[model samples]
Target chain A: MRRLPVYLVLDVSGSMQGEPIEAVRQGVQLLISTLRKDPYALETAALSVILFDAKARQAVPLTELMAFQAPKIEAGSTTSLGAALELTKTCIEREVQKTTADAKGDWKPLVFIMTDGHPTDDWRRGLDVFRQAKTGLVIACGAGPDADTTVLKTITEAVVSLDTADSSTIGAFFKWVSASISTSSKKVDLTKADSSEINELPPPPPQINLVT
Target chain B: MTDQDSAQNALPRPVERAWTQLLEALRQAGVPSAEEGAYGFGGLPPEVRRVLTFIDRRWPGAYAASDSATKIEETDMPPAPADPPIVATEQPAVDAAEVTPDAAEGMSMAVSKQTILLKNARIDQPYQETIALEGVDELELIDDADTGLALDPEQDAAILKGLPRHSGDFLLRLRGWRADRPCEISAHLAVIPDPKSLWVSKESDREDPFWKPDAVFQRVEGELLCIGASKRGRAHAKDGLFRDDHVGVSVDAASGWHIAAVADGAGSARFSRRGSQIAVDSVIEHLPARLQTHVSPHLDALVAAYLSQAPDAEARLKGQLYRALAAAAFDAAKAIEAEAAAHDQTAAAFSTTLVVGVARKLEDGWFFAAFSVGDGGAAVFDLDAESLTTLSLPDSGEFAGQTRFLHKSEFVDYEAVAKRIFFAVRPSFTAMILMTDGITDAKFPTETLFAQHAQWFAFWRDDLAQAVEFSRANADLQAQLLAWLDFWSPGNHDDRTLAVLVP
Candidate 1:
């Protein structure tokens, strides 16, 4: 069976210390718990969590939803989006099973990058390298007013911005992420044409807006 | 000039070496070489394209033009040469196909002997087919005798090994009676070309592999009683799948022995449900007989020597009992291996953890012996002391989620596993419980929790005891154990199997 690999690239910089970090943790737990209940997501979805601060770390490797554990995200120093993207690329290359002549591997991975602020490092180089490799749908969400939408736009066309970083807004964003994942898990079939891309997604709540 | 010589003449040495390296990398990444076939260069990275363009400028026709083709056309093209058709002869009962020299060589080198399972056909039913070859000697059917089809030789061996690259098709005539009744059997032959492939057919999805059937209560009026229940996990239920855990119970009234066994199939294995079923069944069916043959006859002398505190006699007794249990576990592993062999699969496909135990009603109380080959919990509930004693502690590998399977080499290695077998002669115990990791993981997530969770076993015993008494007073207990086993725990959902023996 082809697995639907999902990567959650989260920012755990010093800015997201209090309620925002707690909300992200709760949101991730909610996403996993909700996905575990859905049959399609349980069987097909494989999740990995990546956190970026001064450096990037893969908190959890790609694992089946059945065995997935929500990692504890601690607040760290500067936000290094470049290191995060580089880590995501490395993780995908090492973990995602590529389709071969003899057998099918995993489905194209869905990547969601959530951050509250701009890059402290050179993110353009990482974005260029990532774009060079074949990847699935990448949705970058710029959280709070401090986040740079222009920088995110360079990484992916599907970029969104969150007006605030409150618990309610974060909760709403995570709910949308879960719903989108559930939809993709059901629809994505490697054998079919035009099934790789996320054609339709649940509209984000009022607090979140499309970058365009 | 030759194509190799022309290419050498057309490009500089360094550029040619770089191009060759680039092509090699692409091939390693499952992309066909440009010279071998049309390939899409448009989707490739700019660096790769620049190298390819340089090579193209020097040697025209060396690579496909980037602008000429689309990505879909390049990636989705069928194999260059189509597979050959099976040529059938005039004979109705037997089909004959001639093997081309190239096909024969390919078969000899690339293809290993495989067991092709004919769907909807019993082991007794015979299917006939023939393949004509041109080079070398006779063809043979090397398969297990239990498969029932009459072949030239019954002894199992590798049929494909050491055969000269022959051009003639070997005639295979299968003859056997239908196991059930005389009827026309139509079936499709399914062959698994690669042993590591976990590809389960769509037909297999019809029945959830992890679905556990409802518990069947057998009310036995004796000092010892046995009840076993298996339940599909919440994860499996959400996924519309069957339970991968299986349990079996057997009572030898004459021998005063009640045996319970549980097998938890590896979650990742494609056909582990079947493996767990076979493991449990083999243990229940084979263990009692083995105990009777190997341990029963010498029990008196061994017990007397053991009471006297003789080191040699105690070692002998322990060795004999361990050997008996080990043999039974080995039989279970062998059964799974045999099943995999029959289906042309690897033993890993049927990986499962095994726990089996026998409880005898002694003059003093109960004599218990159990063997566990993986990660699971087995405990004895001491009624008199109102305490729980773990019989076989879970054997976890170095990693947290990793555990040994019965079919794994380490489990089959008797010398390494013999000491792990558990035995006890308690004066009195209310019940004995055997369970898969699913239950223990939920109820007792940590070793500390397991040590502190005597209430968990007490809960089951009290509930089951009441149910048993109620059944005695009214009607039989209607599968309440299954519902009890379905208790939910977050993020720890897996197939739950529990077997309890109570007096």
Candidate 2:
């Protein structure tokens, strides 16, 4: 079976403390619940979480929807988007199953990056590293006004912005992500194709805005 | 070359300039940097390593004197940026000798702030952190009911033992004496439910507005021994959703015709269960009735002519068979459309794929006619001839995961509907199988495989024969067939409907 690997790159910077961080945790829970209900996503989608603050670490490895445990995320110090991007690349290389001669591999991974602040590290170098890897869709979401869409633009062409990182907005973003994963899972198998553009995904909710 | 090579070649010049400026600034404020530079920047981040590699490759180790600090030849180096090799410090060095357990006060261990554990999984130690002391006093977990963790007080954060029964976020508070100072700290841990345990089988409510049975099974024993079962997928069972697949099998004693139909409802459709039910029902109800009415009177003459290789008679029989099968399918689609319209819904809301096969024994051979719309398959397997005749053409739509469904427009053209109606005469067919996408996608994943004789044979031998006992006409055959439909296929957990006919 060819699984659809989904990578969620989240920012747990100091500015994202309290309600924002709590909202992120709830958003993850909401995403899981929504995806579990979708038969397509439940069948093919595997999820992984990479959290970045002072440094980046994989809170959860690539796990199938049934087994995935929503990790307890905490807000830390700086926004090391560079480290997060670099770690995402490394995780994708390590965890995603590759197509061998005898067997089908996983679908190209879909990466959803949500950050609330500007990069506090050398993110361009990380972007350079990320660009080398093969991925399906790389959607970078700027969660709050402080999030730098310009920096996100350098990372991926599919960028979205939210006015605030509140629970409802974050919840809506995760809902859209669940729908995207469901759509991607169904499409990839139905058409034997991968999605790389934002338009391929369902339109974002009112709380989210696409950053062209 | 590769994309990485070009990417590295295109590494911006400003990064190098920034690196050179930073080194120059560090040198101006340095205090004997070369002695501490023996590690060769090995533990630095990739960004730092990339810059170092870039500078070294361009300048031939001019800045990488740190690689061999002992063998420094000052005369062999350029003089413009004259400076001793320097170490890029990742962090300020901590003096180990000055820091004793007794001296260090109010410092937290490197324990994770938020730890995640799997429910019912035993962990000797969830984390590797340990607090070192004289072995007299150790950190103790203040056993909380919320936390399903049991810690050994003798060892400081060394072992966390227990099978966590519940799954949720929990707070773990710790109390211990570090450096003889009573210290208290709290950490958060989340235990997740096991995936296998999360698979709950909930019965779909009969009182629900759009209720359908969790499974349906039927069997007929006669000249054509037929058995079919349609079961709700595990995904649907977990969510208490209806079984969106339907199967119908009928044996006409007078006409000697065995008809079997399998219809799969579109997963995205709101009322597809009814659509599938209507599709399979109409095929069984109308096709046999149409055949009996239109072809029964001329059956003997048609068979005699076909046995004598009469081209005109064969064409007439084929035309009648096509008309009967097409009319059944057309009726199924129209009925679904009518239902949708009555409910003020679009026909898409009741989308379904239909595959129906009618088989009968004749003088020449066993005659089979089929009509299909959507992705499932219908095939006649002949063991003696070692041949398989596929009766249905899969209709894959332009979009991903999209398949053409039985709709009013599907049967608009007579030529098109005639094309969908396929007929074959096999000398002695072992079985005819009509299956929904659930079975086809799992057993024969690709079109190439679906078309292969070897694939059908293997499916009969390995998958079907292993799971079902067709020779036994016993009462439990229905259960056996239903059990066979429950074969595990990862990522292929759609509602499965399989109808088999054996002459």
Best by DockQ: 2
Q: Which stretches of candidate 1 lie over 4 Å from their true place?
A: A1-118, A121-212, B1-222, B304-314, B452-457, B461-474
Share of reference contacts kept by candidate 2: 0.15
Alpha-carbon lDDT, every model: 0.65, 0.75
Best model number under TM-score: 2
lDDT (C-alpha) at residue B498 in model 2: 90
First chain TM-score for all predictions: 0.95, 0.98
Worst 10 residues of 2 chain B by lDDT: B85-94
Model 1, range B86-182, lDDT digits (tens) per residue? 1110110011112334433432343222223232121122433332222212233322222333322322321222211221112232211121111
TM-score (C-alpha, index-matched) for candidate 2: 0.65
Q: After TM-score superposition, what is the CA distance of residue A61 in candidate 1 from its true location, in Å?
A: 22
